[model samples]
Target: MSAFLDQLQQYIERHALFKSNDQLLLAVSGGLDSVVMAQGLQLLGYKFGIAHCNFNLRGEESKADEKFVRQLALSFQVPFFLKQFETSQLAQESKVSIQMAARDLRYAWLEEIRFQHGYAFVAAAHHQNDLVETVLLNLVRGTGLAGFHGILPKQGNVVRPLLFATREQAEDFAKDYILRWREDTSNASNKYARNLVRNKVIPILKTLNPSLENTMKSTAEKVALAEKVLARQVEEAKSKWVTEGQGFVKIDIQGLQSITNALYFLHAILQEFGFSWSVSKKVMESGSGISGKIFYSSTHRLLKDRENWIIDYREVAKFVPVSILPTTQTVRLLFGKVLNLKLLEGGLELVTILKSKSSVLLDYDKLVFPLTLRSWQEGDTFIPFGMEGEKKISDFLIDAKYSLFEKERIVVLQSGQEIVAIIGCRSGQRYSVGQATKRILVAELVFIG
Candidate 1:
């Protein structure tokens, strides 16, 4: 064995990613690096199964690669698994980039098989060159330190034993073993970003320093260490500022500025609220004190409140109010804010207006015939829902800390021209149940604040 292979063997043995009795699932693409990885693992004496994905992008070339990996696995008397994918179609359907789609499908299938067949871990051939290229790509794309962490030796159930090895090292081993590996013609085409980096960018750098790949890989290792420290800081900041309530989290915008990775911290916070990258950016830029101002995402909305941001579930279903036929039993209006109802008090027989309030549970029997629930009006006033006197619908809102915008859109319950309930905030104290009243009108407002 060559000195490089001897070192690689020792590196794998030291990691102990796989045991003598462990079964590993290796993702092979019939490329030089993967072939080297498979062969190297075999030499190290670990039992493994080879899995290949034929994305069908290269027509006959893809099938050819699959055939090579299959035969190679057979030669070693190991089991082989192969799957064909219509990657382009799936990518379009999923609204994701083709590369992302392929990755999602590949690992999803690997885990499924691993669970079914009892595999220790999924292994992929990600050599040092791939790590350097990935770090550069993410840097050019405006990524934070976390992005520069690059490929890990192991993530969850997937392991990359060859991450410490360079492409040159893998190619040298392939040559020494007399291994035949098929190369994808597209790799030389430069149509893909990674291919362009591999062919055009790295070559230019290699000219200046022949050890550019190794140097870049070493830099990635240092960046990974720095990124870990930054991640811990972000986690601490997140715990300090974010509070969970019911179905949403309240983010303190002012406290976020203290975090070193503010952008990453905001991104992770939005992610926890089910927002995507585009929506997360919008929410971050919206700043604070933007009450009722809303930013929409695929799955949720970031709603601004005083001193905080709220992630609200944007209900896709239309609000269809249930029909309520007037009965002696009081009807609950789920749609419109105001409920127009009649109340018969003492024999004095004064016009009483019932409005929405927290404590005003109206007597279902006292609500008069043909009560209608509808939006409030400009002249709306109710004996302020639990006070000794009447107050303008607008003035009641001001007392409740409702923003100016909320005052314009609030629905008021009216009986003819008289204001009854204000949906949620308060009801007319005049219409409240009193002594000597035979029955009471129950009108309540359910507020989705």
Candidate 2:
């Protein structure tokens, strides 16, 4: 066995990545690093299968890579799994870069295949150079301390067995073993950030430090250790300052302000909610200035309120005004709520029905048929229940102390041109069930799991 294979075996054992009896799904791209990894695993007598993803980004080159990986798998006499993806189209659909789309697609498929085929781990061929590049890229893109750790040896089911080796070491091993591997021409191009770092930036840095990979690898390890400590601290802080509810998270402004480097702590607290550092910085700076300033991430929105920062899922569904016909009994609303419409005899019990916010009683005779149930709009006016004067919906929500998210989700039941009930909150005076009412329309908002 070659010394490189021995080193690879030692790295695997040291990391306790997998056992000899354990099955591994190797992610092979027919590149030098992956090819060397396959050879190393084969020589070490581990049970593994080759899995290749043809992203279809390079057309003929991508096909050639798949062909090469398939033949290699046959030569090794192991099962080969291949998947093709329309990466460019997927990138557009997902609204992410081609690289990110490809990464997401491959990893997801790898995990799926692993579970289907009963593999213990999915092996990736990321070497020390990749780790160094990732750290530098994170720095360039302005990441937090977690990014400084670079790629982990084991992340979930994905294991990097070649993380102890550099790119040069992999190339040398392939050459020494007379191994054949396909070279991706794209790697030579400096268009992608990773390629630019690998082909141009790292080389420049290596002039000053010959052992740049090892140096960066050591730095990454130290940073990873520090990250663990910071993580514990952040968790403790979260326990004290953060409170999570059904669909929202609240961060106490005073608790956050008391921390040293409050902005950093805020960023740490908000990162999991998909808030960017810049957005967190803005939230930190907005202290005690105004309430109702909103910040958004792709998945969540943060609201600066009186004493807390409220984080909730950003509602993406566009509200089309739902038409409520007189015959209709049940209608589905946004946010897992169902509106059940029922006509009841008016004289039974009006006081009990008026108290609950989730259900409201309105005079069935007063409302026009085909009422519009839609999100509240600005300039919407209604005479609130027990009031004689018209009040703007906006003013009512403000007086009721609705949060930014609550205001966005508030729906109003409109009879002809006038709003009869602010759903789940208040019924308009025009539609109130009174002594003169014969039929009562009960609109109760039921929450579905």
Candidate 3:
């Protein structure tokens, strides 16, 4: 057995990447590194199959690469999976770079194939140099401690068995075993950021320390260990400071402020919600500032309240004004909720139903047909069920102590020009059932997952 095979087997065992009996779907791009990994796995007698993605970026070259990988899989007498992607088109549609789109497309397809074929893990040929480049990239782009650790050995169902070896080692192993593999010309172009790091940056750095990859690997292992310890502490802190409720996450500002490097901790907590480290820093700095200030991410919004920082998912689509006709029995809200309308006899029976906040009983005759259900706008006013005087929706929300996130979600049911009810909250006095009321319009809000 070759030294490379022995080392690969040892690394896989040490990491417990997968059991010997476990089937692996190897992502073989027909490049030197991936081809070398496939050879090593085959020599070690591992239960594995080959998967290749033809990201249609390089025309004939891409097809040639796919054909080579297919032949290699056949030579090994293993199951082969091939996928073609309109990578350029996908990048434009996703509004991301070509590399990122290709990566997403390949991984998603790999995982899909893995699950369908009962593969235990999807193996990728990311060696020590790739790990080193990733860490450097993270540092260049500004990353947290987790980023310092670089690529993980086993993330989800993907495994990197070759992380123990450098690019030089993989090349040497391939040459020693008389292996032939296709060379991606694009890799030598240095047009991509990764290629720039590989060709220009690392070579310059290698002048100072020839064993830079080994050194970085050691450093990453240390950082990964430290991250595990910090993760435990973060979870503990989260339990004490973070309160996750239905539709919102509340973090105790005082508790966050008391922690050392509160911004780091805040970033750790808020990163999952798509909040950037800079935004996390701003949130931490706004601790002593006035409440109701909001910070937004692509997927979520962070509100700085008096004693807490609240986070909630941002609704992407604007709420279209939904018309609820008098004859309409049910209407679905913008979110996954149902507004069920029923005409009931206005009597003392409604007195018991009125106690439930989810349902409101209003006089049918008082409301205009085709009542509009829309998000509350600024300067919108309505009279509370028991009050004769009008109140601004903003003032109503404040008096009710609704959080900024809750206020954002509040929708009002409008009849003509007046807000007949703040859906799932208060009804207008003019629309309330009275002694003279003959029919009641029962509007019940139904919550659904």
Leading candidate by lDDT: 3
- Return the TM-score for candidate 3, rounded to 2 decimals: 0.88
> What C-alpha lDDT do the candidate models reach, one value each?
0.71, 0.89, 0.90
The weakest ten consecutive residues by lDDT in model 1 span: 347-356
- Cα deviation of 18, candidate 1, in Å: 5.1
Q: Write the per-residue lDDT of candidate 1 for residues 280-355, one digit (tens) a residue.
A: 7776777744567887776776677666776655653332323345552344343233344344444224324342
Candidate 1 TM-score to native = 0.74
Candidate 1 vs candidate 2: the TM-score winner is 2
Question: Which 10 consecutive residues of model 3 have the lowest summed lDDT?
Answer: 346-355
Best by TM-score: 3
Candidate order by decreasing TM-score:
3, 2, 1
Residue pair clashes in candidate 3: none
Question: Which has the better lDDT: candidate 2, or candidate 3?
Answer: 3
Q: In model 2, which range of ten residues has the least summed lDDT?
A: 346-355
Off by over 4 Å in 3: 56-61, 92-95, 244-246, 313-316, 323-329, 341-354, 363-372, 414-418, 433-442
Alpha-carbon RMSD of each model:
6.5, 3.6, 2.9
Give the local distance difference test score of model 2. Answer: 0.89
- lDDT by residue for model 3 (186-293), tens: 989989999999999999999999999999999999999999999998998999999975457899999988999788789899999999978888888899999989
